[model samples]
Structures are given as structure tokens and as C-alpha cells.
Target: MKRTFHHSLPAFITIIFALCAVILAGNAISLYNNLLSLRNTNSWIEHSWDVKDRLKNVNVLIMDAESSLRGYYLSGNKTYLGPWLTAQKKIEPEFKAMAELLKDNPVQSKNLVELKALFDKKIQLMKEGLAAFNDGGLEQIVMLAKTGEGRSTMDEIRLQVVVMESEENALLAARSGRFYQRYQIAVAVGMAINIMALLVLVLFYQLIARSFFKRLAAEGELKASNEHLEARVLARTEQLSILSRHLINVSEQEKAKLARELHDELGSNLTVLAMDISMVTEKLRPTEPELAERLQRASATIKTTIGLKRRIIENLRPSVLDTMGLAASLMEQASEFEKISSLQVNTDISDEFDKIDPSSAIALFRVAQEALTNIAKYAQATQVWISLRAADQGLRLLIADDGIGITAEALKKSKSHGVIGMRERMLLLGGNLTVTAAANGRGTVIDAYLPFNPAAQADASVAG
Candidate 1:
């Protein structure tokens, strides 16, 4: 069994491991997909940030150009002219950079190109007006500046740049939303996998534990059953031995009673008759005066014979037991024992004896007899108590003595088959017997409990 369990354990563990492997494989696939999605999302974000940075630089250049134009219009300083020319040179390259960055987006690229063309026209007009001012044509320059054509051009360029920036912002928003959605999906899938794995592991663990406990319980039950069977067999063998010994004892007792009757009763009677005949012959032969004394001796011998015969009959089978039932017989026996042994005997017999079967009555009486006899011989007891009563589902008999108690070692030895015999009888009758030290460790108490079916007894009564 141990080897079988060991082999089966590995198989069970392997089954659990296989389940975990499947779960891990599924999670790994999800992880791979999530990684791919994340990488794509990161690339999109980096492209959007680069476009936004280029747009920022373009807006800065437009601001510097506008500031320089306003300065030149107010003071017409050549120092402001340097900044305006530098801003002018920067515009084309910045617009071209913005256009290239938005090449993947047609709408944003078109807007960038339109803004660049508008800014170029505005720069050409400003250059023509500045060349006129440098050649002493101040009136034309004033006319161009006052008509606000430069401001109108700046406005159109700004509107196109704003349109291009709006397109880039929309692209960034869309990519961000996709990235967030993918991240949430990955997280949800991972959580689901983990939860499923945990549930499976928990269920498998419970199954294994339940299986282990079930096997353990079966093993324990088998062990207990074997022990119980062995005990029952030993008890049966001991009971047969005790029965054989009891039968022998009963036969010897009967023979002893018969021999005593023959010797004490019939032998005495014949001896007295022979003596009377001898006395008569002597008296007749010599006319003896002692014939009267001899006749009285014969009469006394006849009385002794009658008493011996009565005793023998009582010993063979007490009439008191048949007439008054078990309780009275037990009381009489106890009284006789007390008288013979000079020990005090106390008894409490319930009036429910009529409720007991005759067989059960006999068994209980014999058990009491044996127990008390043992007490008389070995207990050195000053007092003994016997009780009989009805209990739930059974009748109970208690025999206790205030004497030297039985030792634990003595109880274990089973050398005295007397107690074992009593226990076996009770067990065969579907009853139980217990022997324990009396209260206060003063002596020993023996209790026997026997159950009977009142209905069965009633049926027997009707049959009888």
C-alpha cells in the first residue's frame, strides 16, 4: 500500500503541474501580445512628440519675426532689421522641417506647405518695402506698413500653423487613447489568468487533501477492524475453556453431593439398624438391662441421618431458589455465607426480578455466587454489598467489597479465569461487565449490565 501511494502521489503531482503549465502558457501568449502592442504604442508616441517639438520651434520663429517687424515699424532701426532678416532666413527651413515631420499625415503636410507659401509672400513684401526705405523711398514703405498687408499675411500664416498644430494634437490624442486601451486590456487579461490559476490550484490542493484523508481513514478503519476481530476470537476461545472447566466443576459437585448422601444418610441408617438387632439379640440371650440405652442411641442416630439427608438435598438443588425466585435465593445464600465466614453481607434486590428471564436470572445468580466466593476466600473483606436493579435498556448487578483491592498488575495478568469467565458469559448474553477499584481505593467493585427484550420475554411467556 505504501508503495502504491508513493507511485500515485507522483502522478497526482504531475497532473497538477500539467494544469499549471497550461495556465502559464496562456499567460505567456498574452504577455507577448501585450508587449507587441506596447512597443507599437511607444513608437507612435515618440513620433508624435517629435512632431510637437518641431511645431513648437516653428511657433517660436514666427513670434521672433513678428516682434522684429513691429520694432522696425515703430522705430525703423537697422538693429531691428538684423533680427528681421535672421528670422526671415529661419522661416523656410523651419517650415520645411515641419512639412517633413508631417509627411505621413497629408492634411497636416498640406497645411504646413500653405503656411510656408503665405510666409514667403509676406517676407518678399517686407523685403521690397525695406529696400525702398533704404533707397530713400520712405513714403512707399509707410504706405505698405499702414495698409497692414504684413499683418494680414501674418494672420493667414498663423491660421495655417494653428491648423497643422491641431492635426498633430489629434493624432497624439488618438495614439494615447489606443495605448491606454491596450494597457487596460493587458492588465485585465493578466488578472483573469492569475485568478483562474489560483482557483485551479486551490481546487487541486483540496482534491489532494481530501484524497489523502480518505485513504488515511480507510487504513485506520482496516486496522481497527483487524484488532476487533482478533480480540473477539481470543474472547471466544477463553469462553470455551471456561465453559469446559465449569462443566467439570458442576459434575464433581453433583458427585460429591451424592456420595455425602450415601455415606451420611443411608450408611448411618443401616448401621443403626444393625446395632439395634445386635442389642436385641444380646437382650434376648441374657435378658440384658442395657436394651433401653441401646434403643435411645438408635433413635438419635436416625435423627442425625434425617438431618444429613435434608442437607444433601438442599445442596443438590435448593428448593428456596425454585420457590422464591432469584432474589430470595441469593439473599439466603449470602446469609449462609456470612454465617460460615463471619463476614457482614448487605443486599439490595429490586422488585423487578419478575421482569427478568429465568436464564438471565440463573446467569446473574451464578455470577454473584462466584464473585462473592472469591471475595470470601481472597479479599479478607469485613463487608460485602450486592445490588440488582433495572437500568435503561438493561438490568444491572453490582457486587462490591471493602477489602484489599486488586492491583493493576493482577488485573492485567488474567491468571484468574474466574473474572474472564464472568465477562465472557455477560458478553455472550449481549451484556458487558466491568471491574474497577472501589471508591477511595478501598476494595473492588464488579458491575454487570445485561439487556433484554421485553417483547421477546412476553412471547416466551405466552408460549410457556
Candidate 2:
């Protein structure tokens, strides 16, 4: 099955969130490592500068020691030897510290060893010059100075210190360059990650916007389709209502016409036949006794046929509904139904129905008649209650029977034309009918509500 946005949206969002989280976590870890790398590189640069400074300090101390020794040899001043001794005391420790600082670098450590050897040689030469000055006085010292051997050794010492200082400077420059490169790389990586995250966010936003608009458009189309369907349904319902009303009116008119024809035409013809039979019976009674008996029997049969015709006409449209009003008619029907169905029929019909419209009166009477018929056929009970009263600016008729109740399937079935006819009659009069299990839970109740407005009487008259 194809999935809708609603179905897939959560998974899509979850995947996006997970991706973003992973990317952010990776960036966080990368940035932390980069920060550590930058700090280490910076430390290396600082250490290289410190080593270079230390090497320069060692050279300055050696020069001071040489100057002090030369001064002592030339003037034989013990005060000059004091500086020389102090220099000798400080230089070894300084040289050792420089070596310790460079211990991590094998190349620098080797260079430091060479530099220390030169330092020792330079110091030994200074000591020998001092000893010669002490033993042979100023003359030996002058010869020593003149020979240029100590000067040459000092030049080599200076050259060695210069070489060491140059190496430290080179190391410092390399370390500085490395630190800068690491800083640049960290910045570049951070910027790239940020840009990618921003692009992802923008894409997510666009996707959300597109999804929202698509859903909105779909909803709009659905709403329009629903509205069109509702309009069509309403139109069909109205048309059916009108057609049903017209059919009902035509059927009632036809029944009235047929009842009038039977009562007027057939009834007159039967009356004349009865009078002729009575005249013939009088004529025959004086002559043939058997013929007179046959004529009397024939008259009785004609009378019975007239009675049956009257009943059929009454059933078609009761004249009592017009002459005696709704309440009296309902009471009469209740009595008739009680006699026919052998059920106890109780009635409470208010006189307010006397003012009810003629059309509404007919509909209510028919509904009651149908209810009684249904009860006679279906209700296996001994009691029935029929009531008609004024309620809610109209009339309510309730017919209840203590019998087996109507089932939902039976009530809803289309084959129950009698019930459908009752409902249609009530609907035509702007009323409603409901059949339900009695509130007492014993049987069924048929409740009919027909609204009556005195003002609408004029409209009913016009329509009639």
C-alpha cells in the first residue's frame, strides 16, 4: 500500500534527527580533538622558544667567564676570579637544564651533548690560562694570549653556541608554523560542519513547507468534494420528499373519489334493488308462499352486501374523522380495535385535537389505525394504551401495546410499507413518528409528533 505523509512523516523526522545528532556529535568530538592538538602545538612552540633563550643565556655566561678569566690573568685581581668561579658554578647546571628540556628530541639532545663538550673544553682552556698566569706571572699570560690558541678555542665555542642557537630558532619557527596550520585546519573543519548542518536544516525546512502546502491543498480538494456531495444529496432528498408528498395527496384524493362513487352510485342502486325486492315480496306473499320466502331471503342478502360495502368505504376514508373530530374518532377506533383484537384498550384523548388541521387529523387517524393493525398481527398481548394530547405547540399520539416488541431488523426493513406510509404521512404534515420498545420494557410504543400552527391553517387551505 502507498503511504501518506501522515504515515511516513514520523520516520522521516526521526531519521533526520538521528542524522543531525550523529553529525553534531562527530563535530563535537572533532572540535575537542582539534582543540587538544592546537594546545599541544602551542606548547611545543613555547618550549622551543624557551630552549633558544636558554641557549643564548649559556653563551652569555661563557663570554662573561672568559672576560673574567682574562681580567684575572692580566691584573692578577682575585675579585676578577670571583666572577670566573661564579660563571663556572652556573654554566654546568644551565647546560644540564637545556639538555633536560630537549630530552624528547634525539636530534636536539645530540646537539646539546656536542655543545656541552665544547663548553667543557672552553672552560678547561680558561682554567689553564688562569693557572699559567698564577705560575709564570704576566709574561706567561702574555705569551698564552699571544699564541691565539685560547682565542681559537673560544671562537670554536662561540661558533658551537651559535650553531645550537640557530637550531633552537629553526625548531621554534617549525613549531610555530605547525601550530598555525593546526589552528587553520580546526577553523576550516568547524566552518564546513556548520555550513553542512545549516544546509541540512534549510532542506528540512523546505521539505516541511512543501509537505504542509501539499496537505493543505489536498484538504481543500476534499472539502470541495464533500460540499458537492452534500449538495447533491440534499437536492435528491428534497426531490424525493416532494414526489412522496404528491403521491400521497393523489392516493388520498383517489380513495376519496372511489369511496364517494361507491357510496353514491352503488349505494343508490342497492337501495332501489332493496325497494323492488320488498315490492315483489309483497306481491308474491299474496300469491305464492314459497316465492315470497325466497324473495325475503334475497332481500336479506342484499342488506348484508350493503353493510359490507359501507364498511369498506369507511375503511377507505372514515367520515367520522371530518364530522366528529380527532378525539371522538380516536375513541371510536380504540373501542373498535379492542372489540376486534380482544385486547383491553385504554384511551386518553384531549379535546385540544378538535382544533387540529383536517390534514393532520387524517394522518394521525391513519397512523393509529396502522398501529392497531400491526398490534393485532404481531403483538401477543392483552392490553393497549392510546393517548392523544397537546404538546410542544403541537399534538403527540402514543399507542403502546404490551406484546412482543418489534425488532430493529423488522423496523428497518423496507418491506414494512405500512410503517413507511405512516412515516411519510407524518413527514408530509411536518411531524415525525418513532417506534421503540416501551419505557416499561414490556412491548412497543408508537409515538407520533405532529406540529400544529394556527397560522399555517391558511396555507393548508390554499393548498387544499
Candidate 3:
């Protein structure tokens, strides 16, 4: 069955988190913009109030100056002129402050300029009234005031204040409306995002729960399968071990039978031939001397043939391994190898080696024979050292040579049956075989170890 959230689950989860983050970021931006809008609205409301205050101050100062000028003209007292002078100085500054407050609005700023010009004309008219009253009498001042320039200027200033204040109020309303809308949008988006996030979290937890249960079920099945497989492997290994033992026993029995045939059947025939020739030689000696000499040579040749057959039988199945023991068989084999190969063969056999089981002794003897054979064929050594000892509750056989060392490739080659057979023999005896370069970077060393007792009889195991 296909898995529910198979390979793409992680990617799906990552995309969900990314969407949540984006929602949160968008909501945060909305809230920030709303906050800025509210701040701007508040600033514009404050500005409107400031512009009104400046306009009110300007009107009050103009009225005060007009009243002071009239009083000064009526009583002809310079003390009444002090308020007029003070109002003249203050009104211009008030107008300047109002212009600065409304500078962002071009229409309001332009209105302020017109208002300033009108104030200047009103101030000039008031000053002219005072100067006329001082230079002549109240008549010129009355004449100037009757022209209604002061009233016209006050009216124009009132109109400009109303216009600028109206513009400011409109701006405040618009900004407030935008702020409210932005706040509503932010709140709506935030609530929607929070609901989406809750749903995503629920789905994530569901996926995790499902995955956990699936893993738990899979683990149970895997453990059961492993136990079954292990049982099968153990059964197969036991069968192989039994089969190997049977084959080795059968091979050994055949070898012993062949050796017996060669020793008895072939050896008897050659002995009979030698006896007949010797008898003929004695009879021919009385008749023909040359014929008798030829018979003697034939008899000698038959003896040599019988000796060769005996040696071949002994090599096939050495009787010394059973009668004289493992140490004697190894030493005899080494001496024979030396004779055949004309290479020096050194032997060192510990007395404890003879105390091992007969089967173990036989396996070790065969391994030694195989090692010497390989050395004779491949080592090209001038001298070989063969040693047997008892150590670690087992027997160790070490055969070392001084010649060209064995290469890794040669050791791993499939055709190296001599080395493989030696190893199999040791394994059948519940032992191990290791071949390596000699200690002094010289030729090969074949080290074999067998338990003091052979495990079981197995002919194929011995040669596998």
C-alpha cells in the first residue's frame, strides 16, 4: 500500500509554515500602517486647533489696536497709544505663526499671504490715523476711521481664518476615516489568519499521529521477519556443517582403500616378478654367463619398481600418522621434501603436539604436507622452517621460507587450490589457517592452528 503522506510530506509541512509566516507578516504590516494613520490624524487635529488659535489672536490684536487708536484720537492722550503700538507689533507675528501651521496646504498658505497684505494695509491705516491725530486733531483720525479700512481688513482676516479652519477640518475627517478603515482591515486580517493557523496546527498534529502509528506497526512486522530469517539461516548453517563432515569421512575412507590396494596388490605382483628373475638367473648361470647377467639386471629392476610403488602408497595414506603419530609423520615428510627438492628443510616439533587427538593429529599432518608442497613448488627458497607447538590449549604449525614473498593477488586467486585446501583442512578440525609474508620481508609464511581435538569427520570439509 502507498503511504499517506509519503515523500512530499515534509515539503507540504514547510509550505504550510511559510504561508503562516506570510499571513503574520501581512497582518503586522497592516497594523503598522493603521497605527501610522491614526498618528497622522491626531497631528492634523492638533494643527487645526493651532491654526484657529493663531487666527483668533490675530483678530483680537487688530481689534485692540483699533480701539486704542480711537481712544487716543478722542482724548488726545499719548498714553492710550501704547496698546495700539503693542498690537501692531504682535499681529504680524500671529499671522506668520498661522502661515507656518498651515504651510502643507497650498490654498491655506496662499490665503495667509492675502491676509497678511490686508493686515499690513489695516496697520498702515491705523498708524496714519494716529499720526494725523498727533499732527493736527481728532478730525483727521475720525476721517481715516470712517473710511472703514480697518473693518474691511478685520472681515477679510475673519474670512481667511474660516477658510483655513474649514480646510483643516476636512483633512482631519478624511484622515480619521482612513485610519478607522485601516484598523478594521488589520483586525479582520488578523482574525482570519489566526483561524487559519489553528486549522493548520490541527492538521499537522493529525499527520504526526498517523505517521507515528504507521511506524509502530512497521517496527512490529520488521522484528518478526528478522526472527524468522535468523532461524532459517541457523538451520541452513547446521545442515552445511553436517554435510561437510560426511564428505570428509567418505574421502578419507576412499584414500585409505586406494592406499591399501597399491600396497598389497601392486607390491605383491612386483615381488613375484623379482623372485622369478632371480630363480632364472641362477639356472642360466650354469648354461650362459651373459644371459645370467641380463637376468640379474632384470631382477634388480623389479626391486626398484616395487620400492617405487610402496613409496606412492605411503604418500597417498601415510601409515606413520596413525602408528608413529603427527610429529614423526611431519618430520618424515619434511625429510622427503628436502630430498626431492634439494632445499634445506628445518623441523621443530614440541613433545606436547603428540598428546593431541588422533583426528586432529591427522589434519595437522595433512596441512603440513600441503604447506611443504606449496613451498617446494612456489617459494623458490634455499631454506624452509617447519615448526609444531602447543599453545593456547591448541596446536600451532608454522612453516616459513626465505624467498620471494607471496603477493595479495596470488593469495586471492581462485586457482590457488593448495592454499585453499590447507585452510579447509584446518577449518574442518575447528581451526584456522593464515598465510602472510615472512617476518623479515622475505618469502611466505603459512601458519595453521587446530584445536587439540578435531570437531567431526568430514572428507569434503578437509579439502574444501
lDDT of 3 by residue, 1-464 (tens): 87665665588778888987887887688778877877887787888888877877887888888888776765467787787889877887787788678778898888888878878887887777777877878667667668887677778877876886687778778877877887787788888887887777677888768878999999999999999999999999988877876786677778889999877766886788788888889998989989999889878877888878778877778888767777888888888889989999888987545546656776787788887778878778999999998778688899999988799998899998888888877887688999999878999889998775443324423632
Pick the lDDT winner: 2
Candidate 3 Cα deviation (angstroms), residue 363: 0.8
Model 2 scores a C-alpha lDDT of: 0.84
Tell me how many clashing residue pairs each candidate has: 0, 0, 7
Candidate 3 at 95: error in angstroms?
99
lDDT of each: 0.76, 0.84, 0.80
Off by over 4 Å in 1: 1-9, 73-76, 201-464
For model 1, the run of ten residues with the poorest summed lDDT: 1-10
Give residue 334's lDDT in candidate 3 (0 to 100): 86
Off by over 4 Å in 3: 1-226, 288-294, 454-464
Residue 423 displacement in candidate 3 (angstroms): 1.1
TM-score of each: 0.39, 0.50, 0.49
In candidate 3, where is summed lDDT lowest over 10 consecutive residues?
A: 455-464
lDDT of 2 by residue, 182-277 (tens): 778877888888887876778678776887899999999999999999999999999998988888778778888999998997799788999999
Find the number of clashing residue pairs for candidate 1.
0
Error of 2 at 381 (Å): 2.8
Q: Which pairs, if any, clash in model 2?
A: none
